[model samples]
Target: MTLYRDQALKALIPHVNDRDIVVAVYQSCFDWLQLNPRDLNYVAVGAMGQASSHGLGLALANPDRRVIVLDGDGSLLMNLGSLVTIANSGVTNLYHFLSANRVYEVNGAHPLPGADQVDFEGFAQSAGYAGSHSFTELDQFTEALPAILTAPGPQFVSMEVMPGDAYPRDYAYIHSAGAREKFRAALTRG
Candidate 1:
């Protein structure tokens, strides 16, 4: 079930805002954020495995924004270069969150390149991400997520979320640049 996804997103609401950034997130997990397009101070690219890189781009673009990259372990393996790039950029406002089920759950949950075989925390630090850790349950994630997100640095946090891909029906999406700008405005002036 997607229950864990909802729980994780709910657990993260206290740390989110228009000034914050979240990229490359799954629409399923993202749908749980309950954000209006008018609140989009960030960008979440489509397709898979681009959250870290996209979040990295936003972090580099606006170092002041608290950039959150909702990554998938499968996706991280797709573009390992992003970790190195983020580390090299020295952007301290980024947090890479990976929901690992050890498979491409979106693409039929098939085994990804490394899937369950890789050590993402080690990978993050070796690539100079500064900090990295893993969580296996919602309670555990909740206890540590805030500290991780607020740590004032770049990190890759992998959580062993329970698996399911039940995305919301008839939800909203930000497809225009103007909409994103308006969202930023709403967030800032409110």
Candidate 2:
């Protein structure tokens, strides 16, 4: 969570569009994106890797806009088909960033139902992302993120992240109506 959030903020330094839409898994990315929530279009999906799927809908509705999905390894595994759907559909403005913390952090680090074993980069590529890459080193991650984000198509990137405690409280339940409306309007342009 630390490294993913750290690097994501750094990566976002140069590519943030004034009206781009961003959705991150609940508690996975808000701390990072919240640094400038109003300045950048974004949302927090409480359901985990579903951010990628949600971003797909936004991208489909607003193809001209870039949609960034900040997801978690545990969450992404829960719904890998979301990736296939993205691939099979042809919507290309979505970028999925997964953090391989390797545990369900919010749930006291419990192992996933199926031994919790997975290879994110491989899974994403196999599921249809045009290009998938992994990052174990912080420097390499910062360097590669922007290119993948801005290159003009669906791409997947996973980085090894450090787990942190959950947010002090739930924020998704506190969605700002104005922000929601702006985001919805942005997508409706599709």
lDDT of each: 0.69, 0.70
Predicted model with the maximum lDDT: 2
List RMSD in Å for every model shown: 3.4, 3.1
Off by over 4 Å in 1: 1-3, 27-30, 33-38, 41-43, 169-190
Q: In candidate 1, what are the lDDT values of residues 59-151, reduced to their tens digit?
A: 787787787777777777878888888888989999888777677766676887655478888888899887888777778878887788778
- TM-score of the candidate numbered 1? 0.80
Q: Give me the overall lDDT of model 1.
A: 0.69
Q: Across residues 56-171, which tens digit of lDDT does each residue of candidate 2 receive? A: 88789778778877787778877889988987779788888887777776667776656346788888889878778887777788778777877766888887776543344346
Per-residue lDDT, model 1, residue 118, is: 85
